[model samples]
Target chain A: MPRIDGPIAFRGGGFAPSDRTWAAVATLVGVVALWQAGASAGVIPTLFLPAPVSIARALWALTVSGELWKNLSVSLMRLAVGWIVGTVFGIGLGLAVGLWSVLRSPGMALVSALFPIPKIALVPLFIIWFGIGEGSKLVTLAFGVFFPTVIATAGGVDNVPRGLIRMGQSFGLSHTAIIRKIVLPAALPAILSGFRVTSSIAIVLLVAAEMIGAERGIGAFVLSAGNLYDTDNLLAGIVVLSVLGLLVSWVIGRLERALLGWR
Target chain B: MTDGLRLTVDGVGHRYGGLQVLHGISLTAEPGEVMVLVGPSGCGKSTLLGIMGGMLAPSEGAVRCAGDVPPDCLNALTYVFQDFSLLPWRTVAGNVALVLEDRLSRTACAARVAEVLALTGLTDFATAWPRQLSGGMRQRVGIARALAVRPACLLLDEPLSALDAQTRDLLLEEFASLITAAGTTTVYVTHNLAEAVRLGHQIVVLSRRPGQVRDVVRVDRPLAERRAADPDLMALEQRLWRMIRDDAAVAERERIDASD
Candidate 1:
């Protein structure tokens, strides 16, 4: 095996060679400067569009008063509860549908139909069914996250090399053992990718649920601030939501890297 | 303990999606013998090996193991995959340890894994992940995993075809040494004449598609005594080539014709 290869491996980092990290930063700074200038010049009403500086001030005020921390913790607690509920059932269902042919078809049909209907669309129905309480919010959150897990698990199992399964057979392992040993390990990367997608799903569902009926969540705060035309607080809430989504995704990514070490 | 476990394949026939791949093929592997399956591409040598390994079901015929292989076939067989199907998530030792996890006591299991790791020249690789190792090392891990099961019969599915010639030869010697020490009944599949000549006790040559038993040649000398230029080995290689070259040519032509 003489070396004849060029670029056998891609170098991983903050950005690839063709990336636009600097351009993105420049655009962010330009948008902030322009928005602040427009508001100060009275081109846009402060009540309609608070300047980036005022949003920053609101963020600092909330940060110092510890209101952000308290509300952020409450939102995160809801997220954790909802995610755990969804993840456990989703992973169990995924592994089940992935392994058994009898259960896969109708199971996936139900999931495909239910996964894409806006979780918010079900909010009113869930409110009628479970009342305007935690049950409705949780039901919405779980539904949003479960679909990706099922898709991931099935796709992972579907394309597993038949050779690997036969390899297990030669070891005198039973059919069940082959799935537990060979199939699961081989299917993990895809399953993990599915989990990654659902983290975003969890956040989107959480925000939507909060906006519909919640009193203490970031989404509720944004809605209330819009009702009062409090632009600084509304912009601040969006910033907090963005930050929360990023943090949640970052945590899932870290866990994925740690567990799926070979990848 | 000294009794031979003879595998008798009687009138085994099988087909895949209307295309018959094996036709009443029969062969035997005696206990502690290294039986090599050889023939050109699409000759069903692999399919035969699969049937023997119980990875595939033959439409007709049974794999009869007479001695040493537990009367219960599932308890006595192990396989080494060509792709070295080691679990990427598990370390080399972990892959080998999986076979013994339920059966052996932990202390003894650890020792057995350590011993096989050393036997396969994979001691330093016990903690290494599969992706971190080279092709040869991964195959060694596969061999170690099979051996760790303390199986009476070992199945090899073209285990060295993915490796470089040098690595293949080196590993071939290593496999011979390990099997000789263990005295396991082994069935190795490969199309390479040099591998068959170097390591096989009995070389079973198969015919192209709808495979049948074309010839069975016995190598009388010990693998250690059979040198590279041995006249018997060379003559056997020539005979084996004559049996397979035309078939290989036909298979190759079919591929080109299919593509065109």
Candidate 2:
């Protein structure tokens, strides 16, 4: 230290960055505006990629004709039923694998072996087994959703602090009580994050299954539009799918805020 | 008040696989007395505590509990952990209420939770989460949870060791009064000599690993009357430190060597 005449310069402030909601919204709006301008000036071929305004007009026409809800409702039902059934079974088995020594190794082994096989690849096999009906479509989505949920739940359970479990035992808590109260809440964050992954998987598998077979649904509508070379309707269908994803992620964000506010 | 339980450690010895940690440790914690276990870092005091609390099984010997249990005691023996194991997901009141839910009715449980929160001066922070608390406040929640059970015997595993010196000093005074008032037999494990001299009715000094009893110093003074700055207590603290100084140095060296 030579002299203490000057104030020290601060050097520890750049690594931490805060999120800006307005910046994200502005970027999306800017991209759409640029795309619309290019389409109007005929600088880009609308035949290949429809302008955002054309996609919006197609969506409006579909909504007015009731075709949007008609196909969307069917897809939503498949997504809900398949995702719920998969989640219930996955969570049950995951808890078993987490809590019991008898199941941990065998359960994890099966999950590791089966989780890597893409569910989209099983669509043709499912169609042959369950027929080209709702049965096959549902099975495809559920199968895709199941493995990830199990892995997430098990991983969550594994990460719960041992000291907390020991504290529960010391208090003479019953095995069921400990599992329900202590283990479940501790693992909820991981399970919730797993839900985020599984939900996306469910959606992707739903679209793929519908494209392979099925007479109605958003995926069927999109595929038929693409076959007819109707780029506007195809992009409209894609927009609907994107909105569905955003709505789902928004719901999960709310759920996290409500449940994990303590964090 | 109902008589606190007597906990007896009969020829207690523990080994972790090939490593011998504690050996031939026989001692009795008389009803309603504070029995402090003091030793070097690797002296297996916490292992011994776990064995006594029935959380871990010792390699040899047994622990026996005798004497009356209060009717309201939900758990006969409860532990206050070194890390203040409050559930991060639950509020302070909710964490305290965990042990009571299965045993008590809804209203009764709520009442007991309120009572303990008040006892620990945490009534204002009952709805706060553990992550929202300071280290000292978190341990207060731990103590509140332990007291909520109305335990016949309390097993505190270095409960104050995680706090800052000022907080530890402040909480130590509170601990003495609370223990004296409850008259619950306590087995407190720590390496702090000042804590042992201040709180222990019988302070058990242990040697290095393969820990055996080196000495048991008896303090006849009442806990409420004991002070940290008292000349007698200071002398007692110095004496206890002298007993463990060589063993502690050796244990520290062994730890560094093992790490290398």
Candidate 3:
């Protein structure tokens, strides 16, 4: 053992701790700077790869013209509605399967059978069933977000310590009280992490749904720009989607910090 | 104080499939007495504790609790598990308040929680989460939670085995006093002989594998007067050790024989 001290420090070949914010910012700035330089020098064709400044200009024009917000808001609305529907239902069923043996096997079988089928592949089928409108698009996004949430929530519930459950039982806690006071709080970390995964899935499905048959989403904006051969606007739409994903992730991170502070 | 409940384990035998873990183990923890079960590893002391606590069913025989359980008590028999089993999300007071929530009025629950926290010397850490506390402190929280219910019987499964030697020694004295003060019939399972002698009014020594009662020794001296340096305590520890020692050697030989 090392000499007794204030604290023992073990160097296990792990990455040294540092302020990573500056490094992350520097990497992004460096990549954009290199792209801008290449575009100006004509080594990369402007049509093939728009300069960062040009993409920014297109984004500004779309924003000022109120077009970007229109498409972006539509995508956001679809995402919110679909994700909420999927999450609420998934969590309800997940808790059922987690707690009740009668439901576990059947629920697990259905999830396993459906989880592997690429959700995007079912878009045309959804369109036929629900009609080529917001209904079909909402269904597409909801279906895509549903399965992973179920898997994650059920797994989280399963991971709660058996000792805690036994403690609840020994104390003569009612079934509802045991679930509400013990199981839910103990399993919240896993359930919240499941939310993170399902939201990402919802985003992917949102874009795909819009691409197939939609008029006013970021995906639709990109598709129209592609048809018109406007590379700058297409890249601008892609940038908006990237920022949306980053914002969702940041929100989820904040939720985790707030809810899982006990950890 | 009203007499505590009598927990009787009558010729209890337990098995997991074909493997017998305990056999013909009969014992009684009398009201207001501390009964420590001591044995070698794999001797099924914990399994027996679990059975006595009504957490598991014995393969043979039965465990019965008889006496006046307080009418308002939420749990007549509560357990302190080896791992502390404190819910990470709840504060010290909140965890203690858990069993009392449905059983008592809101103010009564809070008062009971406060009382138990004080009893366990955890009043200052009422709002602290389990993860913020040391291992010894967490176990105190466990004790506080169990005591909050004012159970007729307390079943402890190696409550001090997880702590370091110094912490164990320090807590052992506090534990002895606290249990004495509570005066609830306690069934404590431990591998430590010193702890057995220090805490138990009666110590039950068990043989290795398919554990059966080898000897039951009663300590006549009061807990407070039973010091580590006392010859009688030392002698009792040695006697208990000797009882388990032969069984341990025989177990080792049997294990080797089977492996070969």
RMSD of each: 4.8, 1.5, 3.6
lDDT per residue for candidate 2 within A105-124, as digits (tens), equals 99999999999998989999
Q: Pick the candidate with the highest TM-score.
A: 2
What's the TM-score of chain A alone for every prediction? 0.85, 0.97, 0.93
Which candidate do you rate higher for DockQ, 1 or 3? 3
The candidate, 1 or 3, that scores higher on lDDT is 3
Model 1 CA lDDT for position A97: 87
Best by lDDT: 2
Clashes of 2: 0
> Which residue pairs show collisions in model 1?
none
Report the alpha-carbon TM-score of model 1 versus the true structure.
Answer: 0.91
What are the runs in model 1 whose C-alpha is more than 4 Å off? A1-34, A37-44, A64-66, A174-177, B1-4, B69-75, B258-260
Alpha carbon deviation, residue A191, candidate 1 (Å): 2.2
Could you arrange the candidates by DockQ from highest to lowest? 2, 3, 1
- Candidate 1 or 3, higher TM-score? 3
* Residue A56 miss distance in model 1 (angstroms): 2.6
What is the Å distance of residue B207 in model 1 from its true position? 1.6
